[model samples]
Target: MILITGATGHIGAAVLDQLLKITDPGEVAGLVRDEAKAAHLKAQGVQLRVGDYRDPASLERAMQGVRKVLLVSGGADEDGLQQHYNVVDAAKKAGVACLAYTGRALQNPATLANELMVRHFQTEEYIRASGVPYILFRNILYMDTLPQFVGPQVFERGIQLPAGQGRVAFALRQEMGEAIANVLADSRCDNRIFTFTGAATYSFADVATALSELSARPVVYTPIEQPAFAARLHAQSLPEAVIQRISGFLTDIKNGQEATVSTDLADALGRTPASLQEGLPTIFKL
Candidate 1:
């Protein structure tokens, strides 16, 4: 049986849905912390196994009779690295034959100034040292995030960010989840690293242009310095941690760490990945 951690989350939930369509529901097990939240999945015939990445004993219990596992990275917290360590150690001890993890698409996340990327690098190292057969999916920024980053605000007040002319190869979350499901099912995918991204790339300027055309509203992109952007966020009463993360992300984008375009996603899913223009309507509810 295959066990997928964080199965109630967006990516994990989509992965489960795709897996069910391609394979028997009996062959899949979802690691859920709250049974109440997973009642829908249980009703769909997926076996619900209670497990928490912070709890080693619960992970071991969930890993019983499991041959393969997908370790979806933990949420946006400070304990992500330690939580990944706990899951990797338990999976190794359970003698899991194949292990897969979702990580950032940056070639060297540790070298970047971003805290989140550094944690991903640390988790990757820990998984390598665990001696378990593994595959790493380096995922790009989600197109879904565009709604939160630059959306209706652009139509009203215009868009502003620390990113310069830098571009991002954004992929839809659902497509990435489908690719993950395909990789986990194919034994040949073991021990390989894949980068999942859209077929095209776009910059903030390009996004503004697209919105202006689609919405028939004049949207403009204003490039601002990193410190000034942080100050603006602070004025809005955003937490310091959030301001730091957003600023660090803009720095990475400007450094070209997020502009990587790859064909691996199409190869895995046997089709072309959706572009930003194709996914914008759904993301912005247009």
Candidate 2:
């Protein structure tokens, strides 16, 4: 049996959908805190297990009889690392065949300075040392999240970020989920890492051009300083912590951390993942 955490979320639901096609729905279980929230999954014949990353006992219960488990990354608080350790510990105790994890894509992750980015690498280290067969899907940023950076009035306010000219190999979230499910269904358990990415790399300037074409109006790209960017977010009433987290992400992009492109995503899905041009329309509702 295979279990996917955060089954009710966008990526988790996408994985479950693809997994159901290649494997029996009865062989799948969704780890969710409240079973009522996953009634839709249950309707699709997926078993729902009540669990929480912070609750080790709940994870143990969810790991029961599961051969493979997918750990979807989450948590914004400082306790997040401990939560991930709980999941890994529970999976190890259950003696699961494999433990799959969704992490960030970076060549030198150990050199990362961001708080959350460091946690990701730390989690990867803990998983490797746990002595369990594992697959690390080091995913890039999702194109779906581009809408947040673009805001509601791109034509008028234009585009502004601290990312500078840095590019990202942004993959579609749904395709990433599909690729992940493809691996989870396989029984190989190679204990490998896959650079989950899109077909091409694109910068924010390219984003402006795309929006200009879609909106039939001039859309400009303005690279702002990190402090100014944070001020803008603060003007929108964003909390200080969220502002810092977002700024860290922009800093990483500006540092060229997400610039690398890889065909692993296409290889995993047995087809080329959607390019930015093809995916932008759907993501921005154009």
Candidate 3:
């Protein structure tokens, strides 16, 4: 059976949805902390296993008889890395043939200068050292995040962030999920690294232009200083940790860290992933 961690989450659910469309439902399983919450998945003939990344025994139990496992990275808290280690160690001990992980599409981890990317790099290294066949899905920023990053009043407030002219090869999260699912089901993808990115890259300026055309509204992109952005977030009473993460991401984008485009997503789906113009409407609920 193929077990997916974080199965109820957006990416995990999307991966399961894509997998069920091509593979038999009986061959798939989803790990959830509460079986009650996963009743919808159970109704779809998916075997539900109760597990938590914090509990290694639960992960071991969840991996019983599972040949493949997808380790969806956890949250940004201090325990996140340890949670990832728990999953990987459990997967290795369970004798799983293949372990897949979703990480950032960073070219150089040693000098990424971002805390989140660095943590992802550490997790990837731990999985590699486990000696289990693994596939690393290096995912880029999601189009879905545009709404959250820019906020609900994009056309009204315009775009103001520290991204500068840095471009991001953002793909729809659902499409990334589909590509990850396809890779998990195919042995040819095992032990390989895939960068899931859009066929093209776009800067915030390009995004503003696209929005103007799509919604027929006067949208503009303006660069903001990192401290000012942090202050805005602080005035909203956001946590310092979250502020740091958001600031770090904007800095990464400013440095052109996420600008690279790759064809791996398209190749896995056997079709071109949605372009920015095509995806923005859905992202913005337009």
* Best prediction by lDDT: 3
lDDT tens digits by residue: candidate 3, 42-113: 999889999999999999988999999999988877889999999999999999989999998976676565
Q: Rank by TM-score, highest first.
A: 3, 2, 1
Error of 3 at 159 (Å): 0.7
Clash count for candidate 1 is 0
Cα RMSD to native, each candidate?
A: 1.2, 1.1, 1.1
lDDT of 1 by residue, 61-151 (tens): 8998998899999877778789999999989888888888999887556558677788777888888888898999999988888877774
Q: Rank the candidates by lDDT, best first.
A: 3, 2, 1
Q: List the residue pairs that clash in candidate 1.
A: none
Model 3 RMSD in Å is 1.1
Clashing pairs in model 2? none
Candidate 3 lDDT trough over 10 residues, lowest sum? 106-115
The candidate, 1 or 3, that scores higher on TM-score is: 3
Clashes per prediction?
0, 0, 0
Model 2 lDDT per residue over 228-271, tens place: 99888999999998888888888788888888788899999999
